[model samples]
Target: MRLSTNQVFNSHVSSYNKGYAELSKTHQQLTTGVRIQTPADDPVGSARLLQLEQQANLLGQYKANMTDATNSLTQEESILKSMINVAQRARDLAGHAGNGAYNDHNRQAIAAELKQIENELFGLMNSKNASGEYWFSGSQSGIQPYVRNADGTYSYQGDHSQQYLQVATGTQISISDNGFDAFESAKNVSRTETRLDTAGPNGQRLYLSQGTVATQRDFDGGFRAGAPYRLEISGDAATGNISYEVYDKNNVLVPAQDGGVGSYDPTLENPKISFLGVEFTLDAMLKDGESESDYATLLDGHSFEIGMAPDRFATVGSSASAQITDSTVVDADAYAAGFPAGGVTLTYDGAAYQAFAQPGNAPIPSTFDGVSNTLTVAGVEFSFSGAPVAGDQFSISADSQENQNILNTIAQLRQALEQPADGIEGGNLRIREAIATALGNIDSGMMQIESTQAHIGARLNSIDTLTLENESLSVYNASTQSLIRDTDIAEATSRLVLQQTKLEAAQAAFMRVSQLSLFDRM
Candidate 1:
């Protein structure tokens, strides 16, 4: 076949160019230590390498997330530890302040220290991270978690959205918790109050150690819960005498013995003034040189108010005994259980009497047996030895629990300290109540803090596990990428030499072939 010199020359040039290109590529692979410099080098292997590199980058990001999450969790854990210590210290202080011997001045000093602790705790709850974001503010890291109100109380300002960080594919970890659950919104016990009317005599107040005040009475003459009662004492100057009557919140008269008129005995010692369902001893009676006439004048128009007390709790079992005229045994517990929510009235009508749970519930009847002197009604047994008065009556009622919290407990302690147990005007009672409330609140706060700490620990452990998984995945991805895209040094060097030799041979052949042309021979 006849070939043109131009075509022959073009063929030799093409061969040399191809050989030089291969040699350059091998040289590049050897120098850079990468098997493929571009997609054109090895399309399938290059594409696989790209995928492996992306996987490795994602693993690196997961590791970074683990680091960030761990940092946040560590900060939160440290803050919580400090909070627990603070709560414990507060509890210890409350225990010390509760001592009855501590006078008002001493209590005030304790309160000052507690105020500092409260402020400290508030600061801790509103702590920020290295990034200047709140640690307990949930998703609203920019917002403060707790705010102090003008009334000296605290309110949670943050929402309950837990902040999270993605530590892995399909795995997210909580980086923060809200303040409401950790501090402000902890569960507290219930609290109630038994207060006196402001309009009544200032110093002529009454306190009961065992019995709860009935708050309500049914229209059918039965007891009702949440009923407010007051003992009204009225006096006539002409008679030089005073009488007591019990009235409900609505001023309705409550029945008592012999037309509900309190049997007012003027005897100074063992003077029993009985009315409604309760009896009070004149333990701290009138001041020195005070006569019955003087007593009547002093309490002329005043009333003794009674309601729920803070320390009292609602219960299924409570007992009360009346001053029996004879050898009478009363089963107060069984009788009280069958009574209404507030209380009930047991009236003796000479031989037999009736008991009412509520106005419309039912009337339980009891007949006095002179032989056994026993009367049974509603699982209750009342045994009397002598003949009982026809007008005698008894009152029994239920109770409720008080709701409690840390702040209120602290406030109550401060109040108690301000009014130390002086030997006058119920100072002892106030101090005692203050100490009890403070101790309870401190315990509650500690419990809540511990619970939150437990959650923080679990989250930290999760971060650790995720971090390990991320590191392991990163190593595997790197190894796989190396196998797919890394240069085999020995193989690349061998290919480099072979390509160079071929390129030199092609040049040599082209020189000889060009010389063989007829023009060259001539």
Candidate 2:
């Protein structure tokens, strides 16, 4: 068909423009080194590339999380190692202190060193990470874990919650542990104590011997059940005869092994009193020229408690001045009757400190003697030295006679070393008992630290494993992404040359053909 001049020109121009466009695309691909410049270039490959890119970004984030987790766990492991070493040193000091040849002065020197060690342990327990967050504070990262209360007792202020980091799909690692489990929950070997209020009629002194667990199984059962026993003396010393009655926390009398009342002779030395798979002796501290009558009067009407100790106590409100002096669960039945499962909350209304059961906020029968600064409630007697304002609160709860903190153990040992012995024999006995208890608790604390270290080591191992897995997946993703999104350098270069030649040929042909048009030829 014969074409008009304008139609022929339009056709040649269109051909040239198409060739140039192809050439320009090839050159852009070569320059950018990407096959799919837009989704229109290769729809399927572009979509796949997008997915691969997302996976690569996710892998990078996982890698970063693994790094942070590793660093945190490493710091914890190192701190725990240091704590173990310090505990070991303290144990050695305690073992040495138990030597019979060591005098009160020598024991005091050992205790001073122990106090330094205790300070070291305290710092370690409250250690902070590079971000200034407490390592053992669990989810409460910003709060300090261990704090010394005003009553000279150490308490764990952190909750038992753990923090985790996601390192991979379906894989989360714990990055922190609560301080309560690690530092504050050592097993208490000495679970019995003479009542702090036990005194003679004239306020003469008497101390109970450190009790022994005669039967492990029986004691363990009772301790786990929170079974508390009380011993009361009734007979007089005039006839050189003294009888004692054992009662459960409910105030019911317990029969002796021979199905009779237990008797003790004050004239005899260190008479052993046995009950509930445990045995201890009542030692009367007879003063110079003091008679047995005074000892009998001291022993009468006073009670000793077994298998009970304070577990956890805290004072609330900024102005609460009621420091807990004695929180031992003296009367278990009374404690259970007054305090509920959530413990008791004592609030001072300026006139008296009212007791209320926790969680439910039920009021409990309680009395606070303002003159003596003592609050008696739920079979627990709390002595305070400072005046408390209205709305001041205090909370205390007892454990199942199971655990004590490492700091308290060390503190007790230190106190024993510092205090003057009741007498030569009494002082030695007290020091020996303190040393034994300290050694047992320190060992228990060390074991707990080691367990935490092991857990950290396990988490680190998991991180290493996950890291390797993530790296492998990342490599695979990179390879797939390169195949789908990266340009073939050699192929793009050859295509660019061919497209350039085509564009030039199209322009040459179009120019020649346009010249041959009828108008141009005429």
Residue range 49-134, candidate 1, lDDT tens digits: 88888888888888888888888778888898898887788778878876756776777888888878777887887898878999
How many residue pairs collide in each prediction? 18, 0
Error of 1 at 409 (Å): 4.2
Supply the TM-score for candidate 2: 0.77
Candidate 1: segments with Cα more than 4 A from true spot: 192-412, 517-522
lDDT of 2 at 126: 92
Model 2 over residues 83-158: C-alpha lDDT tens digits?
Answer: 8888899899999987767777888899899899889988988999878999888799899988776656676777
Error of 1 at 519 (Å): 8.1
